[model samples]
Target: MNDAQALLPEAIWRDRIFNGDWIPALGGSHTFTEPATGEQLGRVGLANADDVTRAAGEARAAQAAWAATDYKERAGVFRRAALLLSKHHNELSTWIVRETGAIRPKADLELREAGAHLLEAAAMLTQPKGQLLASASNQLSIARRVPHGVVGVISPFNFPLILSIRSIAPALATGNAVVHKPDLQTPVSGGVLIARVFEAAGLPKGVLHVLPGGADAGQAMCTDPHIAMIAFTGSTAVGRSIGELAGRHLKKMSLELGGKNSLIVLDDADPDIAAANVAWGAYLHQGQICMASGRILLQRGIADAVIERVVAKARNLPVGDPAGGAVALGPLINARQVQRVHGIVEDSVAAGATLLTGGSYERQFYQPTVLTGVLPGMRCFEEELFGPVASITVFDTDDEAIALASATSGCLALGVITPTLARGMRIADHVPAGHVHINDQTVLAEAHAPFGGGGTSGNGGRHGGAADWDEFTQWQWMTIKTEAPRYPF
Candidate 1:
């Protein structure tokens, strides 16, 4: 094997794919390092504006032929891809750990979910197309779901494999070509791995293109005329910018943005169970998930007991190199993320919030932190910390608890822990989040569930299962006249 193939184990890493062949990027390349060890891993070629245009053009050219192919044939490719993903799950998980600092279990989970996404997309092939409609006596009318031609997918760093494939699988299943731009921080685990899987599965050439680059490349994909839609998963700020550009060009856009989610513990709940769930939700993958619990709302009756339990749990969870051994938490993605998490914790403490435990950092590792007395106005309470920091706030009554949970402008996911399912259901109904869990934490996802939020959390774009096809395809209404129509002219 060549040196690049040995490092990546994927032949596509030698160059970016365009027109069904590997080609060098015009904008040179960038090097990425392992976040845990700060050691250089590999360099990914950068795609310039010209490169983006070419990818979109190629995808547009190939889309018509691919869409016209038999749906069963398309389904076969995804089935093979799913098998390939499972076959290479261990290697992909290791790369995920090295590139993104995810603990071993979390990395493994991401690969499993990635394979599930591919399988789910394959199942969508059996879903019925547009429904038959009632029409006049002489006219036959029906709605047909058609491919959008080409889709531009931009995925995030955390859970890179699952998130990127979440969009890629559906786009291909619906007979649309795709140009994918994975986060520059995790190209090997995210972009290259995906390209390798599909290529090995015998996916048609020029149907899917993987381009790894920074902001300029992403902007080019967003504004490219040949791209019929843009599906992005990232921060709200970036989503807003992409939304504006897509709107100007009248292109379809689906955004899964940031979250300031909440997890509420009621008075009747068991303190131990609630605390365990909170720790898992707030610290898993170092709280990098969009649905990670940012605020913990505790009823005054059980506030102190639950706080003590949560503190003890956080203190015992191991933190270190993810690849070394069993560890509950891993380092943040990079130095900037560490600095940002610490700054939020320090500023919250300065604003009169109490730091119950953890508030220390070394290099990219930040200890799992718990805070109390966090009021509504504090920065940590209002903003997204996106780390292993959980802010606790006590509520006097059920009304107050609901109010606190709904205070955030953006709602992605919410959790309610109550003694009875009735109470939990009632509280969950009032919250505006996309997903709600009873007697559980806010951080949860499945490959076949509708997984996007409302308000600022997303652009009403649903991903996964049958809902994803809405964003990847368009509905066209057609009518056939069996007789001459009578009209007044």
Candidate 2:
């Protein structure tokens, strides 16, 4: 049996959670193998468009009661969910590590982040849902937040647990029913476990539905009139497609798309400190995160020093099956991802980028690669390589650095390394991004922070804190009077 199978009960990874009950998939079951071992871990039901319509209908029916539930009571459900996630961390973490090929630490990070979001959502429920408004003529007038009724959330494989929860928990907390489609690759951690947690937390029946599906289900979610909003986290290509569909359907969209982020090293920065930050940003989670640093820009004065230290770090890093033993890096999600990553490296080399180290892979375990002399147009510098490769391009002036960072709209998150706070902040502001960091790496986010990017990164919609109210709820104006006014005409 695979580690995932050994860790989970046969029933834990069901195909779908429909109207609060686990059911066999309507479309069929899809086999899921552990990427680390290539062993068949288990299977889950693949939901189809029919299932999406049924699930959305059920959610629509349940939304009214859920929305009317006391805010405190709604908060209580998620509060319990947070504790339940903590209580079952061991089992959930194993599913994440084995299924997603995430290192143990990264798996733990997913659990921690997911739990925090649940807690944040609990607090969000009790926040003021409406506010009194001053009107020109009315005696009493108010503007209030109301649930969107039904929200469709589509999550990706990378960082499945947290990415799924960041949208799901808030949508549920704010009194919207949810129909979720988890990426096929990591259904257990992304969908099944979340359903289990919410079920155990006493979430009402038909309030949430978890569907492990593909394009058909996602398409249904986007076009389903009953689903008022669609929250998606995935590649730029897919996000754009979904955004188009949502627009045509006149549905609200929260899209967190991919990024070819950058980490810039200034002349005055310490090479050791800067290199360590770059390595972490580029190689963490095998660089499968949207915020992972895809390009490294070093000023001429510190280029050699930083590149040398980065290359040394990359060469020394361990790569293997995360499930088998302790390794700094784990396999890619599958052979396809491995091929894509290697292809990018080869293409970049042909484009004149010097491969400093690591341009090979054994099975899915890709080596931590370091590339220097990478120009702006090369594949390594231009594309969002979701792999353990650090591609570097040296810059001469701040003007050139800003131009390089601004050349692409892939700056979902950006980092500038400089001890001079004023200089770093100024440079960061010049580059357009959802989030910016000075003296730090690119990949980092809190559960409660308003998260998303501008332009291709997303459409102004955000995913946490007050952004949740904006994303998952609509506004309405109300008026009340002690007596009915006579006709003024």
Candidate 3:
């Protein structure tokens, strides 16, 4: 088959699920569109409670066989899926760019990173971490990772492919059956794409199922008795709702939620590096990322020089067609996002904050905005903007900067800019965020470290280690005495 045909065959969804191979949802469908451009792409089922039940039933039935499968065999499937992803990289990239409006390089990066993650997952599954023995009598039992019976995954729009696959790989690697409810806005990239990869890897039909729809679908899956865990990535509002439901049901959950992250710059920091880094963090993906550095704290002595450098850096970011390769910034996901961003900027400007550079939105595009003299009352300073808007504030002391950064309730990630290691260590020690980078932009990792938030960010858990893959699983300990007891005689 040709590459296009191989990637998404005609009636593929129907063939896979609607047919006898799997159970189909009875709910209605909605048309999917590209966020950057209002182009119609495809349709996804807005599943109902019955749909969720059916999926859960199938997953419960499938879990035993999946759990019994050897880890190496499971790892082999992921390896093959990674190879397939790389083979069809462009096709996947095109779909991601069209559906999510990620620039070509960024889209490609996500795709490649996803493939790499899968490869890493394969290795991790093959050699999961074991428990260290603490004492002879106690046996310091550390059960290796074993999958939950049924895991329900709810992914976000901003990072459909990467996030969805990130959860799926480990869940399946540890032998859990999964019911994935992808974001309605980008179902093709998140839900449909992942299903195909699992199918290509010859994963059992009911091991991984995708219900591409809205909140009701998610609510149904979250409340379902068959679901043992719920892995969610989205806004703090919705995340709290999920957390509540999960808590009510007492299901294991990993919540990667919201953030109003800050970028702190010290007096000795490099103005050029600091400015460029903040601009990139604020503008990349139109600042839709939870980890986006929305608040910028600068030492009073260097605020002017840093602001000038930031303005210079902001001038170079081109906003246009993401696939065109020239643009650095793309359109916000939709009209709601545009209004949300505009409202924050307007509120900040109205609250006596000074506008430094860009703060205007043209159509779906919002300008790379910079604001100074920010106060805690302004929306940008108080809430997570999730847009290409940066608020720069002057602080007289490290204590003042740390206090300001901690003022907001949200604490997923933060960036620290300092000239000396001593000062960076101090800031790092004091910062409340789960992830802190010294003298760099706020960015997430695809491998080799933990990536999630604190407080509102997520439950404390590492993602890149074998221990993480084990977290998706459960443990069983068995022991035997080699020597017979004298009482037996």
Candidate 4:
């Protein structure tokens, strides 16, 4: 419709890729519409079981050669890919904003972070590999890291660029070939643009394949014998299915799923700082983030002051078209997401939660919402709403606060806002989350950090920094003997 949108590939807008080339799907195509404007952007090819199987087979064929490549040469490809991503940041960010309804600032941040993540994956290549072991016998034993052959990467719609690359870059860096299945809602930015960037960086043919499709394609990838591992980022419900299927074949999986994250405001905290932190954590990108702070636990002594500040900030935040400029919030991904969020808010209010400031929507855009008097039994406090809504609950004592924060199906991240760092660390130690923040918010992530959750939030597979090498690879022990070893006859 515009100059920026015109840059999208017209020929392969409705195609899946195999062997580094776009091919039409035997299955019919699906049209993607802009969430904000409700205008049809373009049609995307829907990969069937056959398509996915072909992609996986090709990736398996390519993996051995790719793995044999020198680590430095592979690192060079990642570095060049990162540079190309940075150079095309504006175009990619525009694509993200158009398809995902992410505000300009959030979209820009995702693109920059995606490039940095690529560079981080490249740096991991230089890290020391598996180490020599201490043995009781007179034999030299060493464990070496080896690629998993073919990795199936399933990414979600929200934060498509970063989330997709979060696994893709690391899998490639580890010398594994990848077959990527991006969400159907984000075919342009998530699927096409990623392939182009790697293509420009001279990634070898068949090393990385981008196949855009839905459930059938995903299932095919999981069940494919050639796919040695699956890296998925999506809802817990789907993650469970993938894990089960992968487990049936004894295939490895790294899953980063949903969270009902909590942010605690201690009595000694500055109300303004606490409010600001919670606001960003709860409402950024319309709170579609996995680590979005859906539950806010405030100590009774400071509850009133923090609520007042938070309500004021939430009311004043901008909500409008992302492309219109300077808006703090934008539309949810689609109408179904809008209905889901609104239903959660209304049900929570009916169940005795008080709507503090905003609880209204116009089309796909829902106002930044805050709630008070949310108790443990209510859906708002218990469920992962994944919207621009923060439910506030007051705790009378430190033990009660900790209990309330830990009372969830699983923990991904938890935050403590306290006057003293020591108190924050003490509370953080008791929380079950993998990531704990002192005097910050729960929705914090870095490219090179060990980023994954414990319990239901993840399958105990970490996705970034050194953790990725472990997730995407397997260990093989090598042994050598200076003399013939004694054997039991």
Candidate that beats the other on TM-score, 3 or 4, i.e. the better one? 4
In model 2, residue pairs whose N, Cα or C atoms come closer than 3 Å (at least 3 residues apart or on different chains), thus clashing, are 15-45
lDDT tens readout by residue for model 1, 1-489:
343433355444644533455678988887888988899888777888888998999899999998888888888988998887677667778899999999988888888888889999889888987978999877889998898999999999998998899999999888899999999899977788888788878788899999988889888988899998999999999999989988888999999999999999999999889898888888989999999999999999999999999999889989989999888888899999899899999999999999989999888989999999999999889998789998999999888888998998788999998889988988888888989999889988999999998778998899988788788989999999977777999
> Residue 167 CA error for candidate 1 (Å)?
0.8
Q: What RMSD, rounded to one decimal, does every model reach?
A: 1.9, 2.1, 2.7, 2.1
How well is each residue in 1-489 modelled by candidate 4, as lDDT tens digits?
454543355565555554577677767687888988888878877888888888889899999998888888889988998887777777778889889999888888888888888999889789877899987587889998988999999999998988999899989988899999999898877888888888878789999988888899999999999999999999999999999988898889999999989999999999889999989989999999999998999999999999999899989999988877788998899889889999989999999999988899999999999999999999999889889998999999878888999898777889999978877887887778979988899888889898998677989889788888889889999888898867999
Clashing residue pairs for model 1: none
Relative to the true structure, candidate 2 reaches a TM of 0.97
For candidate 3, lDDT tens digit of each residue in 1-489? 574567765366642332114345578777777766687877666677778888899899998998888877888989999998988888888888888888888788888888887887787765735565454673344545456799998999998988888888878877788898888888778888888887887887788888876777888888899999999999988988999988899898888888888889899887788888888888888898888998899899889998998887777678887876688888898999899888888888999999888888788988888899998888888888988887888899999989998897768787888879898889888878878888787866665466776677776654655545645876766444556456955
When summed lDDT is taken over every stretch of 10 residues in candidate 4, the lowest stretch is 1-10
Clashes of 4: 0
Better of 2 and 3 by TM-score: 2
Candidate 2 displacement at residue 223 in angstroms: 1.1
Q: Weakest 10 consecutive residues, lDDT, candidate 3?
A: 14-23
Candidate 4: where are CA atoms >4 Å away? 1-8, 12-18, 135-139, 481-489
